[model samples]
Target: MVVDDSPFSRTLLADSLQQEGCEVVGEADSIECLIETYRQCKPDIVTMDIAMPGADGFECSRALLAHDPKAKIILVSSMKDEETEAEARRCGVVGYLQKPVEGEVLKKVIEGVMSPDVLYNNLQSWSIDIFKEALGQSITRMTKTTATFVEAECSEKNISQGITVVIGIIGHYPGSMILDISKESAEKMAEVILRRPAKGQDEVVAMGAEFANVVGGIACSMLNKKDKAFSLRVSPPSVFYGAQTEIASPGIRLHCLYADSDFGRIYLGVGFKKGSVLWM
Candidate 1:
């Protein structure tokens, strides 16, 4: 279930959820209709937007919990503050995702809340340490600057007006690897890689793709080395730019790795289809 005043946001979020193998049973733009929508849809989870007509997300969340004590609600809002998060928790919200939520992050949060034990075991099995090491090494090798692992979060978000490089993974565990960075960050990284200032958007985008390719290649190699049966092939990187670009893959469970450098924050993501042998 998705609730938002903006039709565009609703559609975008719904599409992302659907791509994550979630069935969007219902949508509501106002709190007045939220109860009815929830009752009719009988959704297991709800993504509630903060701002809306009549009542805000906090109140609606409380109402939903009142209606159904088992309701699992995650508050989505553009505002990020301690007070908001505390209040959301007070209202019985299970989770909170700041807008614009990234699809990978959102899916993880949902799964974590739904089945914490399973999510925790899956994360452990995924060998997050290997991916983190690969990311750190790749960034240092490409940029000649040490990259530090900051923090990683999962959410459904809109990457507004940025450069995104996507590389598809094909083999025993087919999936995709994506790198999303701001234009300014791309330009800075491109300059570092080229040993000169990036001239235009084309150069920046190309450099971004190169960065993603190197990182993806390294990660895949490391995974395959750890498990001989996990042979993986990476497709050529694809780049895209737009005002508000969202990416998601249906039936895939996504994980994001965050690294910080002189340029800016880098979001490295790996996604594999649910029920893959890799997870089992």
Candidate 2:
């Protein structure tokens, strides 16, 4: 089951799950619809939104859990932070995913619920060692705000596979991060972020550029956490043309792999070092 206000999100999420051979039993646009559907279907898993017209995903999950404690609800939204994640955890939600939903991420959520051992192992091994830990104060701010989410898209690339670059920014204080990708990777990102394949070939590239910009603004705000005080500024994003371009900056770069997608070489760059172009 999926509960979201956007018909686009519902269709995209359902299509992606179906492609992975998972059965999506029902789709609901509001809390009332979800409650009614839940009474009838009792789906094995549910992907719900944080914000809704009447009763949000959180409230609906709580009501259902009141009847059956073992319900596995996954909170899915464009919002991310310690506070939001903690709230979902308190509600007994099994997992949390940031928007926009991608096939690999959705599959992982399902598999994690079905198999606890896999999730535990991944959690244990997932390290914060390589990435720069944003300042303690900044992290604290992240917990209090509604801005901890990103939406990135890449442009088209002739290369069959793609690369993801995560770039971090640092000022007199901690700043933000950016994940740059090839145009093809960006479009694929759009397909994932928007949760659907391109209706027109041009949309992927166009939307992807906007995705990077918007995601950067959101991330910068989230990372700063003290936006009212610090007022950090985001630099304009730059696009690289070729497939072989590397993130050669001195900051840390972490490589990641995505399932079911050909975008190869995901790089996570950390910190905006001194002497680099610093946007106020």
Candidate 3:
């Protein structure tokens, strides 16, 4: 299956796949149509585009995975930034190919996606310890204070009465990492970073997003160093401020780490895809 907003790109991709001796099962120009088309075609693999009219490929991938946890979806996009690719993985996409992808590369990616060893290798690339180290380093660099890791726990409750900044992780391993801190803590951190009193809610939220970005970037670097095979990328930080902000996705595992600092308590939440087991 091929899903893209552009008819030309869709046709081009389909033709390439066909030339590679793969059957082009179905094509969709939008996310809504793709879901229905997927049901009808039941394709073994789907090549998706990032941009669309209504819902983008990220949202569509999430919907598809919710419907079928084992869906093998690969994103093909011209916007090949680390942020975009990371978000795609968080949406449960199996693979990613940048724009102007070669026919041989696409064929190889499709074949690799079907292999059990490749899937397990991708899953094993994620490390909670690396995540913790990255977060600690980021906090120290930004705030001049070392964050002490207290404990990590699996939780079903939504974050309430605080600001949450989320960064999606992509590439071989797909997941999400969230930095959850109270408004007061956020303001304090913002004040330290800005060298001024943080007054408004917007300022605090922005600081929270920056915190997530810094941590995510460092984490990706550490992960790549450990195993280049992961090809990890991180999405831009997404900020949310309110009481009871739910960050739940069905079939995804959520692991929350509590770290204490002089400023306040910081919660680092890591959400992994269904098949990837969380190693504490």
CA-only RMSD, every prediction:
15.6, 19.3, 9.9
Candidate 1 lDDT, tens digit per residue, 1-280? 9999999999999988888888999999988999999999999889988888789998888888999999888877787687876687578777777788777668767776687556435434663566678778877888889878765666665463388888898654567777888899888888888999988888888888888888888877887675434556689998888566886545566677678878888877777653222210
Is candidate 2 or 3 superior in TM-score? 3
Provide the overall lDDT of each model, using Cα atoms, as 2-decimal numbers.
Answer: 0.76, 0.55, 0.77
Tens digits of per-residue lDDT for model 2, 1-280:
8888989888998999999989889888886676788778888988888887788778888987887787778888888887886777678887677788777667765775667554433322332222222322222332221212222232222233233323334332333344444566556555655668777645654554454445455545653453222234556555543456544434323222212224322233333322211111
Name the better of 2 and 3 by lDDT: 3
Native-vs-model 1 lDDT?
0.76
Candidate 3 per-residue C-alpha lDDT over 11-106 given as tens digits, one digit per residue, 9 for 90 to 100: 899889998999998999887687789999999998988888789888888888888888898888887786885686577787778889777668
Q: For every model in order, what is the number of clashing pairs?
A: 12, 15, 0
Models 1 onward score TM values of 0.52, 0.44, 0.57
Name the top TM-score candidate: 3
Error of 3 at 110 (Å): 10
Ranking by TM-score: 3, 1, 2
**Which of 1 and 3 is the better model by TM-score?**
3
Give candidate 3's TM-score: 0.57
